[model samples]
Target: MRDENEMEELESVVERMQQGDRAAYEVLLDRFQPSVFRLAHRVTGSREDAWDVVQEVFLCVHRRREELREASRFRPWLYRMAYCQAVDVVRLRSGKRVDAWGDGEEAHAAAPEAGPSARAETNALADEMNRALSALPEKFREPLVLATHGKLSYEEIAGTVGCPVGTVRSRISAARQLLKERLSAWLGND
Candidate 1:
């Protein structure tokens, strides 16, 4: 979710959008495109599919704009929509029940100022982390990603994930514990 000031601004934009203001919708798209894309990519594990999710989500939102009752809650509502769409894409591709979670570290890797050896090490660590994250069960992975990468508050994560706050907290804690165990050797704690 956005900061307090941004949230207030977003509420205003959402109000205008609900009233069928195209420019307001454009502002919303610009502000949230990166977040939506990142969530989609984290869930779908493919940039192409993430783009598809973004388009599909916004289209759905636009079509159902009037269904939105509270503009202040738009962030979680958007995330919920994106999550559902990404899950649908994964299900279609795999023909199985699994939540998407993978490969977000590439975007946050160290800058090019790092030496070649350092860069290689960073890349290797990132790869290992991605693998560990992807291996987590859906219940744990979803909450972890929403909290850490999505920067959602516990309450917001609960709303988006359709779980109670306690459940969200437990899942995030368990996800971290599992990741630590999986990466113990690489982290030199074994």
Candidate 2:
């Protein structure tokens, strides 16, 4: 679970982003791009425009964030925005809306061409993590990334989730427990 301080940081970042602060937007982008890009890539199945969808998400947020009054809900609200943008891009491109969480076989079909050993290690890790992360429900996965990978605190996660702090803690706890049960064998008990 997350601590309580991240909300302050997120609030400040959101304030800066709302003020047309390019630096602040850059910070937000840097912080959240992995999860955002992963989500976009999973949805679109196009490595090329997965980046495009990420850009569009922020652009749309920049354009419409002013409409939101509550500062705390910025996190989840932004994700919802990104989700809509990614889906729209996919629909427009493929002439069909993909309802799956990721592209299935096509999702990771664009593996980088590289030496066999290097690719093997990277792909092995990717395969395990992707499978574990994707196994969790969207509710769990979203908060898990926000707390661990994004390093957001419980209060901040609550804001993003529009839920109580307790709920954030419980969900993150459950997510970690599940991942540990599934991954601890490979990682060892250390």
Which numbered prediction scores highest in lDDT against the true structure? 1
lDDT agreement of model 2 with the native: 0.70
lDDT for residue 189 in candidate 2, whole number 0-100 = 62
Q: How many backbone clashes does candidate 1 have?
A: 0
User: Model 1 Cα displacement at 35 (Å)?
Assistant: 1.0
Q: Using Cα atoms with residue i matched to residue i, what is each candidate's TM-score against the true structure?
A: 0.81, 0.57
What residue runs in model 1 are displaced by over 4 Å at the alpha carbon? 1-4, 95-124
RMSD of each: 3.8, 7.1
lDDT of 1 by residue, 31-146 (tens): 88899998888777778888999999999889989988999889888888887798789778874323234453443353656777777777677667777887899899888887
Instruction: Give the count of colliding residue pairs in each prediction.
Output: 0, 0
- Ten-residue stretch with the least lDDT total in model 2: 98-107
Tens digits of lDDT, candidate 2, 91-173? 68775433223443433455556567766665565557656765787677767766654456788678766789998889988
lDDT of 2 at 140: 78
Quality of model 1 by C-alpha lDDT: 0.82
